[model samples]
Target: MDTSGSLSITHLIFNASPLVQIVMLFLLGLSIASWTIIFSKSNSYKAARAKADEFEDKFWSGIDLNNLYQECIKKGQDLIGLEVIYSSGFKEFVRLINSGPADQEVVMDGTYRQMKVSQSREMENLESHLATLATIGSISPYIGLFGTVWGIMHAFIALAAVKNATLSMVAPPIAEALIATAMGLFAAIPAVMFYNRFVSKVEALENRYINFMDEFATILNRRLVRVRSEMNMKNNDVPQTNTQQPSSSYSQKSYNHPLGEEQHSPYSRARANTHSSPYQTPGVEGDRYRNTSRSPLQGQ
Candidate 1:
């Protein structure tokens, strides 16, 4: 008996039964594909993590929004988190200011809506293609099992037709079938591990975006509140036309009007009315306006 470690891999393939050979080939392909995805995803995730870190640092550093937006635009997919936030908040702010009377309340509401939508969209994008990885991880072993089972059945059928039954003949086919199973596990284990890891990373990034959104919105809210307060103070200092008669006359006008009709102004009635046009209402024009008035502060 001669044992040579120099035996060629091709010799092993040639000696394998057709069924086992096919299974081996299929397993090899699967392993290659799995490894390709693994490497691609590993690099992709690393890049994403780096991009997220860089963008968040810049975002929290108090960079100007326009400048930030420009930078995000330049980076595009690289800075997905920052891009989403900027697009959502900035677009809504622009739309609201352009369309609505410069009311702080309206602006803030619109910005909030946009930011929420943007964050959701960004998360979706970040997690894209993850499902494929999950599917491959979950099903690879079963696919390999199928190939193994088919090869084993074919191996038995071949032996039955050969008229000679020997343990030596049986063992090689069984060995080859087991190889398919091993390959399946090789493909599956990494995929499952990576899928779970990537999912956790995505969630962490999403939480960061959300927290930043909340903090940024709060900042805007504070700014808007102060501006609105200053505008209210200015409005209070303005001279009231009717003075002593402002209350009684305004009440009479309200009483004469229907519930949904022209109601009396909130400034005179002190009822916190909702219909007064922030920009066009006469009473609110340089008069003591209620803080509940849904209007952009003049300065904002």
Candidate 2:
């Protein structure tokens, strides 16, 4: 076999019809773009997963929530995925708590909403350019097939013009046209594979983020409950002695002689003093004294 006449890739491309060449060039461009997206998306997914892993390790390490929130803030924009969700949630939690009149359910609701919004934005960022990959995967093969069909049609037309057509004259153009389909498949396969892989990865990461959000919300809810209980306890334990004393004094001055001096009895004096006592039940002790005094009079 003389290898001197063998066609190279460059030769096939150059020797192809104008329409086939255009198809080939278009497929080539798509291939290049898909590979570029693959490399970039590969790096992005890897980094996002790594950051999520790191943040989860730190989050579940039993460190204080405040400390974790502070650390994430220090990391600033470097925080990705779950870290961003955690930071946004905790920040909102703290803001609502510190702003006074802390309603635990309200705070948690706000925090959860903020985290969900952040998660959604992060998912969008992670899924960027995926549509382009899918388009390339689905359309590349059809584009290549179109080129092949056009080349075959052209070849048949040219063959009709010839007085004596042979296999040698027909085979080359058909083969060259098929190269478009080959390029299309080459471009489509990896795009499809990586697209599926990345989609799974993004979903996994998304699930991880959602789980973290739930867990973080649980921790926050517990803390909010504890703080609210503590505040309620403190409020209950507060002494109202100062407020009581003034009210008792006013009552005694206003009602010192309900029956007047002429009708005063030992029971009447006891009743007056009882009414002045701040902690005593109103009228009960006075009624008991009056009944005892009347019983003594009845016995006499």
Q: Which candidate is the best by TM-score?
A: 2
What's the lDDT of the predicted structure labeled candidate 1? 0.60
Q: Return the TM-score for candidate 1, rounded to 2 decimals.
A: 0.68
lDDT of 2 by residue, 124-190 (tens): 9999999999999999999999999999999899999999998878887888898999999999999
Candidate 1 lDDT at 54 equals: 62
TM-scores for every predicted model: 0.68, 0.78
Off by over 4 Å in 2: 1-3, 242-300
Error of 1 at 201 (Å): 0.8
> Which 10-residue window in model 1 sums to the lowest lDDT?
291-300
lDDT of 2 at 132: 99
At residue 89, give the lDDT of candidate 1: 85
Against the true structure, whose lDDT is highest? 2
Q: What is the lDDT of residue 270 in candidate 1?
A: 31
Q: What's model 1's lDDT at 47?
A: 66
The lDDT of each candidate is: 0.60, 0.72
